[model samples]
Target chain A: MNGVKRLSAPLNEKQLLNLRAGDEVSIYGVIYTARDAAHKRIYEIIKNGDKMPFDPEGQIIYYVGPTPPRPGRVIGSAGPTTSCRMDKYTPLLLEKGIKAVIGKGKRSEEIKKSFIENGAVYLVALGGAGALLSRHIVRAEVIAFEDLGPEAIYKMEVEGFPAFVCYDLYGRDLFEEGIKKYRKE
Target chain B: MREVHWERISKAVAELFKKINYYLNEDVYNALKKSLEIEESPVGKRVLCQLLENAEIAAEERIPLCQDTGIAVVFISLGQEVIIKGKNLEDAVNIGVAEGYSEGYLRKSVVRDPIKRINTGNNTPAIIHTEIIPGDKIKITVSAKGGGSENMSAMSMLSPAAGSEGIIDFVLETVKRAGPNPCPPIIVGVGVGGNFELAPLLAKKALLRPLNEKNEDEFWRNMEDILLQKINSLGIGPQGFGGRITALKVSIETFPCHIASLPVAVNIDCHCHRHWTIEI
Candidate 1:
């Protein structure tokens, strides 16, 4: 309910520390997009000790598979997919030095542990709000796995992209607190 | 016999795809507005507001409400006296889906094979369910089902003695387990009293009912009312962040079944809930 915080990508520890589970923030700067299939491929590539497409250090990855842009638009309706599908491969990405993730839904306990250990956080973009979310993305291009169509990883430049910190580095989870606060006997 | 051309059906299906995807249904839209008015949590209220805005933007810009344009699911009520004049109903529907998706610039979300994981390219081969009815007209209902909510759907065959309380528990448990994954403020469609497969089918059919509509049977109407309240009480809330208004509606359709079986299924639909019907 307070003023919306503005944060830049490749977020630092101080920034991550400042955020709480329910704080709303609008992200700016570059973020990477990847979803179910791309995460699997990322897992295999990392397992084989191959070079990743981009530097993971201090980066934020958005779990999205955007629709194709109509003629003149930078991108189509880009929104967060469910985060759980990418849970299996998330630890590997966090271990590689990713700073934060933007998605929807709760993460696994293992993922929560990794967030604390790796100094990362999880953010949630409103699900089923694609058309509104797309308004924040200013530029987009496929950065890897072009053959996967919508599943391809894209590098996106976003301005004022709204998200809520769902799982924080301090082990506070908004999802858990949320249920407790709202459920009336 | 009343004769109709397959091409006409295909063209109508194509338009249905274009219109349904671009605009949210009035009943669903109004239900969300009402949820926005009554939602308690600030975050939950914000989510509902965004959903309404998203629906408006999608409609004004002619864009999809969600990127997951969904799998094409069709329910057809064909009159016994109606004769198709062209190729076939199923083929025509597939062609329409392909054209509508491509021409309207909707995302093709379907895969050609589930295991191999190949993109179907055109979002074709719709899941068509047909029932032969008594009249000379054809009625078609089209729903574009996104994978998220569809994946959370569940079915169970309970002993007749498990009874009503068992059903209440099962439905609540299914929803509680789903949490935010199915995109709460969801629509829960429940099927009761049918055999295993038919129960799930009926559950899916229940979703096709208008959000503002309730079951005609007094017993089922009361069941819908209670289920809707209990689901919201779970505090899953909008986008599962917790608040009032977790589900917009709960619909239950039933069928007579064998004395030994009481099959129940829950089919969840996200708040986006897209579908349309046409009679020809």
Candidate 2:
């Protein structure tokens, strides 16, 4: 096992791919938060030739739907939701120059391929670790679709936000490799 | 007949919402801790470690275990002899749900319609299933079901000839297909026998049981062991990182069904497994 790294956020695509499973990384800086609804909206925007809510180039998208914060808190229980649900919209985002995605669970083959081809990476935060993750989010504000409730797009500033690289730019998936190594006869 | 105080029930229900959200039940917490010890894959073990730490932080900070606090699903067993005082039982339950989610700051994840997808702001109108049982006390089991795991649930009605082997295969296949999507290692609640909807209902009900608690019936006990072995063999592991334990536990609940039907339902619950029960 290698020691964890604390990289300032807004990391480039190549920087994200350098992260690997079992390697702890604390991210600092700006990240966009969105889930199924916002992903759909983003895709719709792309399909309609409309401008996106945020620039996708060199950006990291986090797949999350946080609970409403308590008084004085920035966000609530801000953990990653399952990533597979956003598979359909991911390739579209990658095409627009999105560098990385942060979420939990395995992605589809198409999404995995798109990451490799587009020089993007898929990072996985611990699912169900909402409270722990929320602690890292220093500030949060809705950037778009406030009416989507928790599923709305939010721009978040995080410090020491922990994540692991589930899929790297080199076309390797930690999930697949782990399964092969541990599968029972 | 025992008089049931609607106010008391509402209070209990209200607290049920917050408790289910803020705290990871002891069984689930302990199971996760155990998983960290037994998991063989380095990545899987690390994921489990993070999960255990997350539970502690969530409870101490009084925050939800997951961002998707999930739809409020309650199983109420009302004593037949109890009489509700002052309010309609259904309305009382809904009010409790609304108050709990709003006041507790839990996410309102429910939608008014699946198609139109209107947000029901306060997570009201809980999916309440009430059964009248012979007792003077009312029992309520609160389960905050995450969409990720609930979406992975599946049910099937096979020919009676397919039998237990078919039932086991169906459950294993469903989990394998789910892969990392449902957030393994998951707890699988299996309902055998019963009709179409009832089978799934039974499976969901079985989830209320503590993790790793074996069925008391000898026949069901053996079945549980076999299923547990088969599921772990899939190597889905924690967070699907892959390990020796794909499933923390498999609980089966059954009832006699129509002779022509061998209905089976598999209800998958993520590692969070947030649930709590209250008897009032």
Candidate 3:
């Protein structure tokens, strides 16, 4: 098990603060999937003063656009998209009470700052390991923006979904620290 | 003259996309295995292991290796002495791509227009690059490029005087800025000396070559080795978690150009390397 930390969805402030960068986490329970288009729409809903599709309080948002599953599978190759594309929209979501976000790649300095202020965390999944990650997603159902196809938000039930803490509430960044530590000249 | 049907092209294109998406190429697979033995960071080692396992699971289960099955980029070489029976070359390729994505259950990632941003649903209208050669055979290569890595690609027009050092610096800077965004342990394809358009195409083509293949010319061969070393030393490591194996390979392609132009382009490929070729 390599001391892998077990976590559940809708993480609390204490749990978010306890995590450290680079800690391998096995997450369970509900995590919502949203990528570029859905984020835009969610942001619009907020801008228009409409009721949010789902409450964002203490919820984990996974940035993904999964493939269509084969007949027997619940989901297809599901993995993290780049985190940077959602950078412009993240602060608003954080303010709306998103506790954690999961994806691959770098987040902006402002996004990191937002994480600290909101007491949220940033985690990343294995970017291209969709087949491996799909095994942990036991259920998936589109909850909004079905028109967006793969880009729609899906409420999913996950079990032992693998991720690593990339940004914690203290404003530490795994990507920045890891690169600096290993960079030679 | 030889006669080839468009349907065969479509069938091959469809099969090729499916095969490439579901199965990791043997060279890339072996490289990851080798990297596992040498990666120093514990998390980097774990990531390498997970990638190998992902490939196995993808192949065994017959699902795509990644959700971003990628925009279809096809390169075709048609023999000058050949005739198509069913459809035009471009139409045949796009039809094949549409069939493959829909039938194989690959994600439809392409937007109808760059600005409008509407999904085409079937993943049609593949980006096709074609050339006419001497023989009567048709050769095609299909690559699925993920948006995450593709968006990080860059190009620049340097002064002819900037020379090789300038290129090294540009490529290094691009990698540094990309950090983990392109999904490190990336494959960097560099093109030098072509015009604005050709330079990027040449860079994209460099990615289609096998990871184990080195450039034929001695200068380019050494350049590849140097870039590989420099990139790995960046220590972005696998998925930018940080470690010794940031880049698995760096391939450069070049062409003669105007003395005044020194255009260079770097196209980054994620570790998936979803490319396959067929000859007919």
Candidate 4:
């Protein structure tokens, strides 16, 4: 097992890469939720020099669009969406002080390069493990784009939300590394 | 012609939507469990465990197996001798979908338009495909395809000269390019020898096959084994953490095509592979 360090809500790139795909992570802190629509809006904000709704510094963004919760529930099955869809907007967020991204799937080369240059890291939560992920989110509220429905930007407070480091600041990728180690000769 | 009751059909469809969202099919569940035993990498084994646990929790809690909840894709095989009664068949199906999605708390992932995309609110107007079969009994299959894996599906028309080797190459290329994006340890559904559009449909239909079941035809059976071996060799492993089991299974369905054309379509289902069938 790799060494695990429990840090505060906002984690740095070095701290993020310490995670591997199967490694269990307990993320305690603030995280933001954004899907395709919200991503486009965030990009527009960056392009127009507008202030983002939440502070990006040391923040982690989760790429998810959750189901509407039932009565007396915080939120419905909340799992990560494919991360590659956010590739275009990710570099921009990292440039603005965002330290980490949490989602599924491999990111593009451009996004990975930005991760190295800007000291950002990518984390992955199990894609279909919605109920499992939902157990981590203690609280959630829409911070922006309410009309976007599930795609709305929501600030979520999670306790011990599990994730793995898929991409590290050093440009090493778990997807690539795992394949090399396990592929038959 | 015998009349079919829309209300009954609607209720059955609604139940199907709910049951599939809450329950992972037995074949898929068993396959995931088996994957853990054969998976070589430690990380891969962990991922498989989480998936298995997730399936159990989702089923027990009656929650969606995945957050995306997927765009509702229904395949209906109707009996030609059956006639519809009461409400319009299409409307009933749509209502069933809306109610099922709302009642089950499945996410409404569908949008109004692809380019000008707007949330449809209730996940209504399911993408329903209907075909008239020879039997009097209506068979319906529901597959909740998550966006991540759906986005990775691809289709191509190869020259008739390409043959099985060419088809295998295309499938491998598509999986490699998809990488971790499609959610690794995927089930690859390959449809070969049909027309352009039919090829994709056949590919998707192939996914409904039992996970461990082999094709009856020896040629297709060999193709399935070869593809499965090649895919796992890619080392995409569970959730792309890199492992021996890049794919849990590779299922192929084929039809005779024109002499000049060879159509191939690949549909990828994530490990969740949420699906169920109901007949009423």
Candidate 5:
């Protein structure tokens, strides 16, 4: 519980500059969702200089592909997918002014360096905690690439969406530093 | 010979798939609980707690524990004295899988073709493995294997000279390389001594074993224990946040292989570890 930070999304430089690798944070706001298929499409749009489905400036993109929601629910089990798969498309999104990225697992060194150059942050959510995470997302609607099924881009409003900064602007990696303290071999 | 109706197979398959995806197996749940007790890092503990709560929520709500409800991997053991009636056995299972995925609100992850990548929509045509056993009863095991962990699966056809030391090193290398990608505190299923294809199958089958149960052979049991410690010592931890418990269990299954080959495979299952069995 100690030292956990609370911040709202669509963040600014002041909010991000203070964050460091390994810092726990609970985010509150709307976050755009995109996984492998959606990222590929989004990359194509950016490469063609077409307007993005949603403005990337000062926003967060969560890598996820959730299940179909039941009759009464706002969303289905929606947790972060692996982030490494999106490394190729990230720099373009970052260049467009996105503030943060959320997903599970390690990102490549190149992506970490990208974060530094772009002054952005990488937040790692608890992977496989879909059921728990869904409770935090109050609303979700597909905004683009509707034919992609689960991979469609979704606009979601979340509260207390928990994550930890895995990479910050300084290029410190939580995965590398976190393992150093615990590895015996 | 007992006649087992195909409709019964389809019904059981549908129900079992739904049940396993929504409610994680008891053995897997207990392993996570125990791991939580031993897990030291605050971040690791937090992740474990989230997983524990996620399982509880999924069970109570009748929703999947994870969104990637997985490709249905059905292991069917048919009695030598039984005959299947109604539809073809494989068709019946596929029907059941499609119905279950749709009805249960599970994600339809299977696609028609690997390269073309169009969703099969109903999650149909399960990966079915059948075998003949001596008894008169039909036993079915359904495991919803998520892609995250399945992507981390590894195999190597090491030379006979590589021996135990070589195999252990491979296991470590694979797990370390997998890191957080497979979702940590993973169940490591290792297959040793089978032929090229069978080795990987054995690895996947090894995951179905109860989490607490050690290998029946003392030699392999020792190997499991040694591997578990070595893997945990790597410090990947829960979701690779870094802690004491990187893997909840290491299960090894072996079979006789050719003298010239030492085939091995590692199939990683995430902490969700959704699988169930039924006999009818």
Candidate 6:
């Protein structure tokens, strides 16, 4: 793993290229939250030639459905959910110019290939580290699908949100290396 | 007959859910701490450290440990000598669950049906498992089982002669396949020799045992050690980043089975095993 790098959201090509699998990053700026249900909604919206709740271009979508914020708090224990469930709709979002994604667990081989092809990256926040990650979220507002409750689309303003690059633009995958390094015969 | 009011049952369930969701069980917390001390991979250690910090934050701040507060799984050991008064037992527990999730601001993650997906709005209709025992008091254990780990669990009907080796292999294969998805330093709860359906139940129940507690039976305790060693050797590590501490503990609970069947089930519990028990 490389030293920690700092990057802004809606990452540019240069910023994306700088990321390699296993590199730690502290991301700042706007990110959006959408889990399985929200992704399905977004996919249908695109299929029907309709607009998404937010601009798809140059945006990072975090696979998350945060617990509702308590009174006077910006958010609850907000952390990334498992990302594998989003495999079906992720490539479609990438094709639409989505820049990066954040979640835990490995993506499918096909999704990783798309990340390389589309110059996108997948970030991993430690799973089950929800309360710790919430400290990084400065603000959260439901931008769409409020009926889905916690599954609604949230416009999140984050500062120094910590994650590691698990899948990168160049087709590197940290999870693969992780198993190889430690698996005993 | 000892009479227990439905309101008391509901209140107990609600309070248990609220407490367990926000607080990490001391056994699980200590196991994670011990795992952190010996985790070989730097990344794995870092992840474990974050999990530790998350637990502290959740407990101190009174927030749900993870956003997925989970489908409520309640294990009730009812005393045969006691009589429950009020709404039926299941209804009372569901009412308590609804109150707990709503009042405590925990996420309501239960869907109405597996085939027809619809959010239940309030986390209700808990997966309740009840057993009658000879006592005047009842024991209830509530576990907030997260979906990620629960999805990784598996059951198999091994050949009758497959024996202990077969059981070991099944548990190993399950953890290997689970990889990072179940959130390692997982607790492997293995149920061997029970009937097909009961095997999984036994496996889930095994998870309620404290990490530091060994199986009361020597043979099973040794089996737990072997399985745990083999699992950690797979290098799944913390959060599946690769390390020597893939599992914090392996608990096996068994029951006599029919001669024709050797059913084995593996139920994986994430490091954030949110479960608590109270005697009422």
Interface RMSD of each: 1.0, 1.1, 1.4, 1.1, 1.1, 0.9
Query: In candidate 6, residue A34 scores what lDDT?
Result: 96
State the lDDT of candidate 4 residue by residue for A1-185, as single tens digits.
Answer: 36444545787656765654444567898899997889999999989999998989899899999988988999999999998888878888888998888899888788888988987777888888898889889999999999998999989999888888777766678878888887775
Q: Which ten-residue region of model 4 chain A has the weakest summed lDDT?
A: A16-25
| TM-score between candidate 4 chain A and the true chain A | 0.93
Error of 5 at A155 (Å): 0.4
DockQ of each: 0.76, 0.78, 0.79, 0.82, 0.78, 0.81
Judged by DockQ cut-offs, the docking class of candidate 4 is: high
Candidate 4 stretches with Cα past 4 Å from truth are A12-23
Q: First chain TM-score in every candidate?
A: 0.98, 0.94, 0.97, 0.93, 0.97, 0.98
TM-score of chain B of each: 0.98, 0.97, 0.99, 0.97, 0.98, 0.98
Write the residue-wise lDDT of candidate 6 on B200-256 in tens digits.
Answer: 999999999988899999999999999988998898788877788999999999999
Alpha carbon deviation, residue B229, candidate 2 (Å) = 1.8
Per-residue alpha-carbon lDDT of model 2 for B248-270, expressed as tens digits? 89999998999899999999998
Residue runs of model 5 more than 4 Å from their true location after superposition: none
Best by lDDT: 3
Compute each candidate's TM-score over C-alphas.
0.98, 0.97, 0.99, 0.97, 0.98, 0.98
- Give residue B1's lDDT in candidate 5 (0 to 100): 92
Per-residue lDDT tens digits for candidate 4, residues B12-126, read 7778887877788888788888888898888788888888888898888888878888888888888888887988878878888888888888888888888988878889778
In angstroms, how far off is A1's CA in candidate 6?
A: 3.6
| Collision pairs in model 1 | none
Worst lDDT 10-window in candidate 3 chain B: B176-185
Q: Which of the two candidates, 2 or 5, achieves a greater TM-score against the reference?
A: 5
Error of 1 at B93 (Å): 0.5
Scored against the true structure, residue B87 in model 4 reaches a CA lDDT of 88
Q: What DockQ would candidate 3 receive versus the native complex?
A: 0.79
Question: What docking class should model 1 receive?
Answer: medium
Candidate 6 local lDDT, residue A176: 86
